[model samples]
Target: MVFALGNCALSGQIPIWLQNCRKLQVLDLSWNHLNGSIPPWIGQMDNLFYLDFSNNSLTGEIPKSLTELKSLISGSSSSSNHTTALGIPLYVKRNQSANGLQYNQASSFPPSIYLSNNRINGTICPEIGQLKQLHVLDLSRNVITGSIPSSISDMGNLEVLDLSSNNLYGSIPASFNKLTFLSKFSVANNHLQGAIPTGGQFLSFPGSSFEGNPGLCGTIDSPCRAINNMGIQPAISSGSNSKFGRSSIFGITISVGVAIAVLVAIVMLKMSRRGVGDVVEDLDEETGRPHRLSEALGYSKLVLFQNSECKDLTVAELLKSTGNFNQANIIGCGGFGLVYKANLPNGVKAAVKRLSGDCGQMEREFQAEVEALSRAQHRNLVSLQGYCQHGNDRLLIYLYMENGSLDYWLHERVDGGSLLRWDTRLKIAQGAGHGLAYLHKEPNIIHRDIKTSNILLDEKFEAHLADFGLSRLLHPYDTHVTTDLVGTLGYIPPEYSQTLTATFKGDVYSFGVVLLELLTGRRPVEVCKGKNCRDLVSWVFQMKYEKREEEIFDSLIWNKNYEKQLLDVLGVACKCLDQDPRRRPSIDQVVLWLDGVGTEGTKE
Candidate 1:
């Protein structure tokens, strides 16, 4: 049996009558206004393996009796029997619907306990680690105090464990490295101290998992100081009155100072030889003019991929080709920086993105973009040719698209509306969908910003998704991740304002806005005086509701002969723009629907 009433806005404490349903296997009451403490009787439910009471006003300490859950302590064999006998249809909803699961299949759901985002307090009971079959345990964003229970390492089957944004102190259990199956772990924004455990699954976790805990160290960026097993730094006594000790310390300090001065002098000599202190204006014999060489590119290598056509490319040649990234060579502007067109010495062309902003912020964007582009390789995705880190400047090289971005064609060019025929527009949508589908596959990647400006067009007008500076990696088990709200204004999903979370569904919403731009030949946000100003999404919905769907098409490409095809695509776009993210279809589904439209059009 299962009962899920999440996001229902229900008030008051959890009903006591729930104890009467002894056979219940799943109970979800999250995202509600329910108050008061969790009932102790809840631990008496022997068959319960999935319990979620997150995002509530619940208070009081967690009942220690929770460790006695029979199904979670042993296995789901008993719950499987009940599910087989009742054949209940259970639906799990975590921001999105799970499309009802049959009783037999429902037993396959991972055992979990969620009590995050609450006011619950009290140290975690060490005895609660008896749930050996539990797969997920989350108790984040609460006032829970005290150290993490070291006994939790015994839960061998655990996959995810989150304890962020709590007052928990003390060192993490070194034995946690024994959890071989653990895939995700976090204790961020807590009072935790001591060196983080190493080896096993801990090696797979990112540094973000241990953030906000300054007392903790041992990460690549934050190395731990020399300390004993008890985590205390050793200090020398200053009360010594011996003359021999004073002389020894003074001699060692002088030797260390002399060594540092010698090392600085040696480094300075090397820098001078590498052209850091002098600017050499070497003239190109063929051009009869001096070649431009940026001082920032001193001794910096221009790393290029094996597939790059520009062989023997150097940082000096790259600077000379773009005239040191002059304004005249700038081809476009992106959220991060300007895009300069580089005419390589080898007769090949490439686009160089010179990232702007503070060094720290630009460094993050540079790394994010490089990491994303390196992993995602599809026919419809832009290719990253190379990159360079020259002093404070960061540069990314890419294959220059001859036709430029879709935004320039759709909105900037006067004849763009007439040039992009209905068939070409349909093809662009299909290609973009396929590219997005690939990114949403195994080891999913979310393009936080999706708009026409980020979609480039090749010589053949094929769409290639670009600008991954705001992209993020999302594992299969993760539903969503909280991040700073970043995206183009008109393309941002409505739910982002409240949730501040990015998901695959959010990308679909932004793509829907792009589709509207294609069909209407209008910008996402129309600028006008008085009451005439309105966004394209609102305008499209108003027209559809008023039985004026035919009027929403771009007049330049609209043809009565292709009305059926246009309306079919319009329906697909409408589904993508569903107000509730759960109702929106996945990118894979969108690809199939689009292919169906194209197939039908061909047959006719």
Candidate 2:
């Protein structure tokens, strides 16, 4: 079972223990960059024969020990293994059909040698004459400038002899006449000279097989043997051969230059526009304006930021994945950016949000906002992959959520898909609480525009807090001032309409509205008082206190045996809706209550 996997172009050094395959019959690693001296252990492969490693990056002399396989190396094996060193050992016992051929994963065998097309430049080891079972002997395409070893002629099993495209010169041994079984023989494109044998299978090949030599008379039509320059060998030294050494060095130099140029460009751009507070951390090269997972909470090992794991994702990669911000790929849109569905080059589906250019000169503020948002992490919050800043364009990358925003599935008709489950609703609330809790306590960042539109949903029905552009990260040292009000009309806190103040309590109020929507299966702030509606939250609250809770509960929640659980959820939401900001429970407290409820539900 000899394999002829030459010129594979597969990079990387071969892993060491391939010889451990005891069943290996043939191996062909020729015409590749498989360098390093031929290991002597190859002689241990007793079932090998047809060796053809003529032209490759292999270095050092041929292993003299290869002469040992006198009785074992055969020329033929399965054709499939003919192109690879790996072979699947067939199991006749597993064969249920008439013919035994079947494919399975656990089966394996190895092919024989073909380590050519390398820098193997030494003379052909005379010991190769001992391979009686050898079928294919191609030692062409090398720097070995010597006569063809006379011993090769003794191999009765040799069918293919190609010693062409090398620096070999001098008379072809008359002993080659003894190779009666040769089928494919070639010595073309070499410096070999002298009279050629015109009989046997040699007659079939024309003078072209004997080209490149000014000497060497042959019986073929060209009569190259008629030339008198005979028995001359070319220089065979392989000196200072670095392969890609020159280009690789050049590429490294260019990469460094480009990186420096980018640094200079960023500096020039920053110096031109001052007054954005001295964020000295950005200039530190050791840190490189790193992207921190703000919500990272002791999860999987892969979640932790490791210097070895990932490189800073480029803007081009993000753009390509998100279809260069195509309108057709838009999955969700927000005040600051439009989220688009995209497929990464690595075949990973992702959600990429391309923000509109900050026309009023808010790009830096927007970028800082997104950076702060991207670093924040929570189980209920969407995972931000990385962000891209390509000139005036900005994009935020997030883990692709199969299920879209909560607004779509909750408010609009699902077209007959499964409704949100009570238990799932509770989980969503808890995860959302965790995110809000982080925003409230960890950094005190207030999501100014929290609502059903911003609570994204994944396929698992988990909730993620998104759209942080309107979000304002609290200063650790100074207070932030807001003189103008901003937020959706429906979910905006009652006081926010009259006062321009923003706080975590305002977000909690909005969240309360959302919780009520989940339970009532109604839009938040719908005025259902009279025929209109008392804004879903107000109506639900009035119904709950009046002991007519079921009137507002969606049938999905009312009919289920989980009324007690839904009531607990309702109570938590009610706490969030307290009029006084001081009266409302902090998001962390809300999270704790949901966790307690989750624990209780687990018992059922």
Candidate 3:
């Protein structure tokens, strides 16, 4: 039997009559205005496997009886035909539905307990570990206090354990490293301290999982400092045993002398080579990369969106995955930072962009912009997985693109031009346009930088716009005014030099340069004729004026069959590169024009 009345706006305490439901398997009273402590008699139901009293005004300690549920402790499987046998419609919210739906069996739900977002107090019963089959245990957003029970490590099947936003204190149990199956873990916003346990699943958890605890250390950003003279004896008393004290003083003098000599020798050696001393202070000996130590040690922050695929990602694991951002793993570089290809422990690949600049003052603004970017999702845009801020370093994690950037295909590779057929190139242009159009919509996000290299291609050759919103995130500039310019030199709009501001039309102008690259096999700025240099936009305009447009198309991709479509796209590109920003077409209009290029019976 299942009795679910979640979000029903029910009032007062839990009903006493619920005890009569002797065979109840699920009891959900979440998201109601219910108050008072949970009745201990509810645990008498041996068949109960799912219990939820979340989002309530409940007070008092978590009843120990709840941990003694026989069904959870013994891992008893529910009857497959329980719903059918009762002939009653049972509403359940499982993987199939976020809202409650009629289910044929109560067994579909996991054996779990949710008592979060309440006023529950007191220590968690250590016997909670007895529920060996419980898959989730959320006690977050509460006033719960006391150290976490070490016995929780015995919960072999536990997957999600959230105890965040609580008043809990003390060090995390080192034995928790034994929970190999634990995947999602968080103790954030607590009073926890000491070195975070390493090994097993703990190594996979990101620093965000331990954020808000100022006392925590031993992670990649927060290296633990060794305690000096940890167990050494105090100074010897002088009143008694002068001979013994002298003996002790002689021994201590000899030890101190030898230690001072060793230190002097090390200092002298370091002084002999300043580079060696610098490397020792800043670089990790294992990875030979800069260490993640921050000036404000415990305050380094990392935020991973819940939708991120790398839920178990950690800074340490990311370093290990990318060989400490090794130069050999570098896939791309731009005005922002170097992008390294990271092969995560779970077999998922990602692009780790180590952002450049002093981000100490822009922490709040940077986090806000990144959070907004995380919410902006589109099929043709590279997803922002997460971000980390340690010292002056800022890193943004993105979904890895398999085929690399369009710039590599157009100019870097010797034979890359031949591989991108006319149809494929047109497809990439349309996809990038759609992504830009979406960004220009409500809550108006202007991609201050757009170029061939910023456009990434996936396994299917579909284009995904990358580095969007980063120009504003990293640089201290606004839409209306700026002292410094941000964007590739070749892609900067003419109006930007005068107005010193970024706009949607400026983005369109940059996209036009990318379109020119796709149409004509040339860099945005390249040497034209004998020792003369010109931008692609001006050269294209000059060729059009002289009626030499045919000579402007890439010799490798130009074909008699694609002449009409190529000419139509060239017209669109010219409009986007208009000298006046106001004359340039909006991204939406550009998308419509690109969509029409190959749809009018044009062949590849």
Candidate 4:
């Protein structure tokens, strides 16, 4: 059974006999007035995946035994995975069904544990890292004390982590960079101090997420003071021991003699040419290519997504599957990195993009792509299956797109004579709009780059936005100004060139350019007279002014039957391409207008 007696209003300590129900997967006892400490035996059930004890009068420290659940680490709810010497299975369940709350159920959700709004106290156990497969962990509104554990960083598959309204203290851990899949993170109303972790998911979270913690510093509002030492140390006495007097003079004399001998030996060694050559060789060895991981070991980590078939996945197996990233398996290459097609042992096909660079800037770029893809999930956005890191190598795994990118269909006639139908074109535009709208709505996110080449299509020709290496998450303080200007040439707006600020309106302008590409089927910048060229937006605007709007439509899509609907979409695209950013419509408005056009066609 998945769920036991939930919302039953039962009073008294949780019955220890529930441990005997070994097959229970979800146990939600939230929203009750039950009192007493959570039993450690609850962790003994191996097949459990969901457990909720929120909104109760439960007390005492969270059990370290809860982390022993093997299903939370291996993505499998079976007793055969983690068995104690006594042959008992370790089990755990993540339950959040308190108060009958309805949540947006995406295609998949990872193993989770929610124990919020209780009287629980004591520090979060470092042993929680044992649940490597956990995705959502909420321990909010509790009286828990002590510093946040650094071991929490080891859970590579964690996505939503909320520890708000607690008494957590100390600096956020630097090791949190390993949590590439983290999307929603919070620690508000806590006693956390020192600089906040600045990379990975930390960058995407708005200042609101870290609001109530005044001691915490970094991009968030409050700054930590310069204290000599936070932890208390034992007081030292001024009095000297009688035993120290016996060897003090003798030890000082011997130490002086040994120091002089060592100085003389160093002078002789420095005079030798062979010794200097050896020193230079050692320096070069340390500064050269990354030697952090052994080549024999292949990789250091392999993290799979929630419903991945590669349960027993390993870095060694991935390397062997790609034939060491040989050119023969190369399927695509772009500004981010090279893509290789890999067939895993469970018959799951994936596309792996190998980001190759040792520089800090490149590392940030790789992290941005992973974090953005993990956070923004829409039907029109490509899914990130997982990621791998070893030495200087960084690889991102995504579901393979069979139909390739939108650029291929527009420029290269991959399909011989059959042009994309008008309805299909409208559907692709609507799907892309949904994705862009979602990104624009995110607090700090701005997709700096949006072009045809970055949009991939599936087997059904459903559009999925791809390529987020250039995406930027502005700090909450910066309302509309950012100095770093990064985007494709033709898609960038005129206001961006002068002000160097990225805004939601700027993204709308780029999407307008994409819509124009779909309608006219022409490149952004087309060559005209020698050394001169006309941008697609300029040409379309000029044609509209000259009363020649019909001349610029794609010869294949141009027909009296589809003219009315095409014209309606063209008018919306033109409004998006308005020279003034303020005049351009919001992406949400664009979607409504486009939806109306589709509705009108259905009525006809």
Candidate 5:
């Protein structure tokens, strides 16, 4: 009943809470920057069945206790919280080797082991042979050196043996013939030197598992032929025999024999779907390139991120914080959700965004929105601390913004100039500009609804852009065509009135209107000439071009001494309102302009 924590940028040592999961059965914490040695105490969790802790920076000797666990899956795991610890992810169980191989029948726990993907360097403790109930042994992707202990043959119930991606050196033990229960085996990317097992389950695996081991000659792809003149090409038919049978409730083994007793088996399971080697190419975000990787050797199984999926807050914990959505606690309301301030258990401050009433098939939309926005991790953008998805309800938890929102800073009375200083305003503007620009780049994240209301501020007036409900994830294959009007009036690009979709140009158009709001202290929509202009766009167009550039300033913001600088900033804003979407500057271009790049026309 365990869930995965998936991939995260988390680093540092493993948390204490993980090793002491008394009621826990499954734990996963993989694909992170976690460092340090594996904690030995985790081996005490007797109830665990699936454990993963891989792709980390952990170092030290592999604990002998790991082999004691009776049931363990072959995968990766490690919590994704970065710190300066000397140890981190390494999921192992009590090894039943010579040190503690003395089996106490009274200790009838069903836990498994998973302690690969670390900096651990040492020999496989021969004591590992004592665990009679061991089902899966994975010592892959590590620095564990030395020969494979022949005692491993005692694992009569072992189904998977992955010693791939390691520095283990030695001949494949002849004792592997005793592992009749083995399947899904791999020993790829290692420095092992010797002959792979010939008969029994050893011949079922493909050639990829033995690729890097130069000295190892196998029945599978090597200059050296199989022992006893057997073929080197792997046999596909061996795994189809009685070894992988499933027992039926009626005391019959449902393998090829039993199925043949009924009717002939029609077809074999697709080979590629259940990978025995490298299957597909994937892009690594950090490297910005493609790398070969297998989908998984097993089902939607254990990975590293599952560890955080634990310690999650409950629906009740959320409901109590906002006082059941009381009006006094409410900060703002949006199209698809409402924001509320809440004080939760342990004095944690949180802002909860509750989604609008359930839209039947919108779960994918909800998931997409959360996943997209959650990926943006920067100091300028508001941090999404956590989230909750209960049945029909969707809630997002954000780190509290202390300075309230930009809407208040603008519209609310700046009674004393102290409330919103000129220096702070400039800083806020620069920060907002940078955040918006990042959203416009490759795999461009379009913040479809960018307005002052969505511009939030924290203590010290550090601006953080928030509210990404209408965000879109743009990629190369995207046609960028959609029939939906986004953004507040005036902020919407004039070009968008016809296109009815979002684009980087539309964002620039909106940013221009926001800039105008800063200059003129006017709402996007206001009255002019006894006719409602509907928004600022139409009015600003008139003031800037109709021999009236100086008039477009909010009086308080327009100190006579700063006149030239103000006009220069406003001119940049004016160009952003280009009638043609393509003419608008990109976010990076906007930043350079703000930084005084190509400013001949901006100065007097």
Candidate 6:
């Protein structure tokens, strides 16, 4: 599966050459900087099972050719199988046998087509009805206009349908009552009017699904009215009659048989009572929250800082914005949990961090942490917007960085052009240092995890220190905080392994490793000349002692023009990496030195 190409700074249109990859099954190009209209040839791929083009600059009408995929159309069985571009098999062909047990040949998950969060304008193509096997279809957060298509009811297997945040007007098609398999449906934030459909899955959906559209009526609060001279009110149904035949006699026998089976089931249940309680308890403990929590924990009430656009946010809104925390919305993952790209109801965007594990004193500690972090704000620090707590699960919402993490720009080589220039690098380091200095000034605050991945970048590539989940708030009288070692493997200070304590010096050591990463364009741990893994600090010092400083620095910035500034930062890095914590310079001192380096770069 091709997943998460988002924030990779990939520009231009979808490459036409991709159409040649006939075996491609899953294609995800979400959250990228790609522009231009989607190529129609995408629908020509016979084996394509999933396609996502969300959160891009793509425009124009969705190609009607998408309906041509045979696998997506009902009654058409494809004998072919396909693998992803990486040569990983995604589907296997089933052989036809005369006397062998045969399973249904259709895809179990159902094909999904997502084209949300784009500039794609125009009416949704009526040809969409041809994709009868589609399970999920999302066209939300776009500029698409026109009436809601009644043809969508043709998709019998559709389970999730999102058409929110659009300008579509007119009554929701009453034909939607035929979608019995739909579990999640939303047409919120549209101009649609008339009576909402009743029956089938519509009965179970919450009012939020129909929110934002004031004209629409039926389930929520809007009154129903006649449309196009037809009565729009829900029709009351009367009971119907049926005739009994030989099949009725068989039904009577089946009723008696079911009664006997119920008796047998009760006896079996009584005999297995010794272990039944334990199994039920284990299930409850494992899931932690009930299955209905997704339904009950509507968007948590948002308590963002003033001037933020998400004043009207709630837990239900958060769930809907992130597609119920769908894997497709994941932008990053950490030891605690995953972070999702959350789009607020007011069209503002943010990042929502879902923490793993269970609740203990967390409910109390969570409030304290929020209070402290919210108070400790700086230009170089990421803003903690708000949080959500439901049962044992907790979520921390923050600002969404457009440029992603520094690790990605440095290691993944995603940012296009020479974006990682020496001057920019100096500015980033200085900003991060300033943030560290600001945090250290607080009452015994120690950021236990300080790595490039935790250092996020805004659209301008300015560094923002984040991910303070492992941070310890020391008492006013305490010298250090004793805590379990928690940090990325390569960035963790060596002394931390034995001391089992977190200190400002430890944060300085980790920052030094980040400086080395910036200078050398090398990871904290990498294979050396002998093909053996060596830490960056040892490798850099070894090269320095041997009079090969030029060889250890990033080739892109290793020039006489930049040697002076580079060497000065290298000196600071060496001081920060001192084996003894006492010898390490304070974060405040480091910040001053970095500011000097940045000033020197600006002068030249």
- The best candidate by lDDT is 1
> Model 2 misses residue 200 by how many Å?
99
Candidate 6 segments exceeding 4 Å error: 1-302, 360-372, 414-417, 527-533, 598-604
Worst 10 residues of 6 by lDDT: 94-103
Assess every candidate by TM-score: 0.53, 0.48, 0.49, 0.50, 0.47, 0.51
Q: lDDT of all the models against the reference?
A: 0.77, 0.60, 0.74, 0.70, 0.60, 0.71
Give the RMSD in angstroms, all C-alphas superposed, for model 6: 21.8
**Residue range 1-604, candidate 2, lDDT tens digits:** 4343545665545445867855455454544556667777767655454344434466776787777753233332222231221234332111122222222211121112344355666677776776655555656666666778888887755666777777887777777766655645778777776667755546444455677775566552334321146443222212455333666757966998899899978965774343233221121121222232212222111111222112334434545555555555777756555578987766667787766633332464355555556557677777766554444445566778888877766654332113777777777777777888887777668887788878888888888988777777776754443624556645877776455677778888888887887787776633111222525666776777788977878776575567777777888888888888789887777777778873563121
lDDT of 5 by residue, 1-604 (tens): 2423535578778788776456344565666678887777766655455566766687888776665543332211132111112122222223322111111111111233566666778888987877655565677778888878898887666766888887777777888877765655777877776667776656545676678766777553344534467534322222436233334313433364577655522321331122223212211112212211112212111111111221234445556678766656777666566688978775767788877543521343455556556567666777766555443455677767887877666764334223665556666777888888877764478887778778888878888888777678878666364634445544667766566667777788788877777777665753111222324677777876687877778767767776766777787787788888778777777766766622353422
Candidate 3 RMSD to the real structure:
23.7
Which is the leading candidate under TM-score?
1
For model 3, the run of ten residues with the poorest summed lDDT: 277-286
- Cand. 3 TM to true fold: 0.49
Each prediction's RMSD to truth: 18.7, 28.3, 23.7, 26.9, 27.0, 21.8
Q: Return the clash pairs for model 4, or none.
A: 45-91, 46-91, 49-93, 49-94, 50-93, 50-94, 51-93, 51-94, 51-95, 94-112
lDDT of residue 266 for candidate 3 = 100
Ranking according to TM-score, highest score first: 1, 6, 4, 3, 2, 5
Clashes of 2: 45
As for TM-score, the candidate ahead, 5 or 6, is: 6
Higher TM-score: candidate 1 or 3? 1
Question: Candidate 2, TM-score vs. the true structure?
Answer: 0.48
